[model samples]
Target: MNSIDKELLIKMYMNMVKIRRFEEKANELFLNGEIPGFVHLYIGEEAIATGVMFNLNTDDYITSTHRGHGHTISKGAELKPMMAEIMGKKTGYCHGKGGSMHIADFKVGMLGANGVVGGGFAIATGAALAAKLRGSKQVAVCFFGDGASNRGTFHESLNMASAWRLPVIFVCENNQYASTTPYRTTTSVENIADRAIGYSIPGVVANGNDVFDVYEVAKAAVERAREGGGPTLIEAKTYRIKGHFVGDPEMYRTKEEVNEHFENDDPIKNFKSQVLRRGELTDEEMDDIDKRVADEIKEAVEYGRKSPYPEPEEIYDDLYV
Candidate 1:
């Protein structure tokens, strides 16, 4: 494999760290009754978002799932507004109206996170269609999970995109289990990428836990889409270390299983080890980044706490009839 630029690798590592830290902080706040609504922590799936987003330009569009904070952050969403949004403050991106599952920053091309399973399929496909119609090189990425592949929207969007040769990339974050059910039981195919065969598109699978692996695959797909090569289906094989939600009892999976993944397959730890071994980045640089991220997260919590809640009269302000 070709060596990635040291600067880019460092940036990717930083983004992954940010995603993990933000999720950890959010989990803490949620447990402490500081954050409102349901929180789906993307603790174990940082590499996929960080790597994929790194390959995308600010003008490139992406539709996200409920577990979307990582996507938003990786796409350049400010931490303060994101934290405020999760806490339901008026200073948030949606003015606190759209909580954890619905955060969006159109300026960064994050086309909102969907609460419904597989909801992003049509939206992303539509964005790609719009780009194609406008005769632009922009591409749209749809980030869904293994569970969403079962939805009709997935098939419909893939078929239409393939037929029209839309500039879109279908990224399936196949974290093994969909909610509480094992994807093995629910999914008909062994790998979600295999589904792309039916749509007559390229199907590729990558190690979602490895940022470098994900970056390479996503880079190729993004490039292909920008060059009008049509959509590509990338299935990222990883695990969900956390429960479905913050307060979930998680009776479906065993603790030993979760612990094993957390300990051995930790993306951040593995990334650091690999880079450090290769002398790509110094330990001091990584330590400084860790310190900076900690400080930023601390400030974000403060910002969210200090921000006022939206007034009752403004409930219908951003709503469309």
Candidate 2:
């Protein structure tokens, strides 16, 4: 708990709960057809986003993946705009054009959530290079999946980032599957972090289900980057509790495996138990945070519902071509 302050610890708890509940709401809305398009719910990996993002500054940049609502929310994006974006409302972050896979808020240094696997690599690397050139302390974080690690973009980006000594961190959310194929079947390495050896940068691995574990590791990496120590590769071992996308048949895994993670490996529940056991936070405090987050999410969904959809004629707007 070297990096964990009481306030930040509590905030992390609140954020974890917020991400979990928000995804649950998104799932409900998608099932009801209130939200259009495919939604890959980030239900189980709440700790990874909350823990790693807990110490970031407003100037720090973060690139997100398709399962990115959690990252967007953790990076301090407004709930209303995010919900509206997912709902395809005109008031959305991208005027509803980007939808769930492409919500971005540059003011907060969130580059964007990309639908393409490994798409954020170049953007994050570029952001890091810009920061270094401008003599700024901003660090860039690229969040990709285990599947993305196998792509050429990952290798190309890492090679450049390492060579330049850019202030970037590559975070791989290894959920053990690339769509329908198991990660082990595709990736030759046992641990994704091991690949960092080729780049000659620090490679670290942490339990994604444990917020404190992630926080400790991320804090060190962030501090090192700010001190001009260059890039780090972090592989968070997490599990996706849902199908790759909403309405997926999910024949790749068994129900028992999913249920086991839900019951035994739930990060929120584990954090709550740890905090209560250590007297870090009282039950009343935890309940209060939960209530507040619930209310916030409730209002966000209502706002999205009441928000107007983009007019058909507005399609030509915000386009370069």
Candidate 3:
């Protein structure tokens, strides 16, 4: 904590709060039928995105999963456009075509969020290869879930990145479940990071709920990638407090378990307590941030509501094929 700057700490805290508030508002809007598509809420995994993105430059690339709003926001995306994207408006990143899951901002190096499970691995790996081929120091981070660890793309991309020494980081948000099934039931390995050994890359684990821990681990990995030390596999252990989608039945898990994690393992709540206890930030400052974030979210909602929808004549406007 002493090694980290005070401003960076506050910024990380602010981003985390923004992600939490944004997701909560999105959930409410989805329930109210304002959003058009499936919404995968990143309610419990704020710290991982905030911590990791803090170490990156604006040009650094990232490929996100279905649950990607937190990643997009942390990567310097504005709230108004992001909210508009979720609401399927013309002012969105995708002009209302890619609602909820497929938002992209090439200006910020966020390759489009993938709706396919494990879809980001190859995209991130390829982006890293592009940087390497161009003799640039840019690095790419791939954010996926525990379920994606079992996919063929996960193995193939890692093998290729390790063999060629691509500057990439594979971050597995091990949020316990892969949709309706627990990863424990489907995955053979005890830890997702352990698979990195097969590709001869460093495998590490971090407490995803702890912003400090995630920042430290990601900083080391990013530094290594920049210095030509090859790729890293990071498994950020976290839990998904919400259902797989906005309105999932969630019959597999108990309400008691969910309630326990929400009470004890919520990253935002834990972050506020830790910072205040260490005298790193005052309650007044945090409260100010909270009020500002609430106002920002409210404004974003209004912007999304006011933004126009795409016209019927433009169905193929941005299509490539």
User: Which sections of candidate 3 miss by over 4 Å?
Assistant: none
Q: In candidate 1, which residue pairs clash?
A: none
Model 2 local distance difference test score: 0.93
* Candidates' C-alpha lDDT: 0.94, 0.93, 0.94
Q: Lowest summed lDDT over 10 consecutive residues: which window, candidate 1?
A: 1-10
What RMSD does model 3 have?
0.9
Candidate 3: deviation at residue 301, Å?
Answer: 0.4
Model 1 Cα lDDT, one tens digit per residue, 146-230: 9999999999999999999999999999988899899999889999999999999999999999999999999999999999899
TM-score of each: 0.98, 0.98, 0.99
Q: What is the lDDT of residue 130 in candidate 1?
A: 97
Indicate the TM-score of model 2. 0.98
Q: Can you write out model 3's per-residue Cα lDDT over 116-195, one digit (the tens) per residue? A: 99999999999999999998999999999999999999999999999999999999999999988999999999899999
**Which model is ahead, 2 or 3, in terms of lDDT?**
3
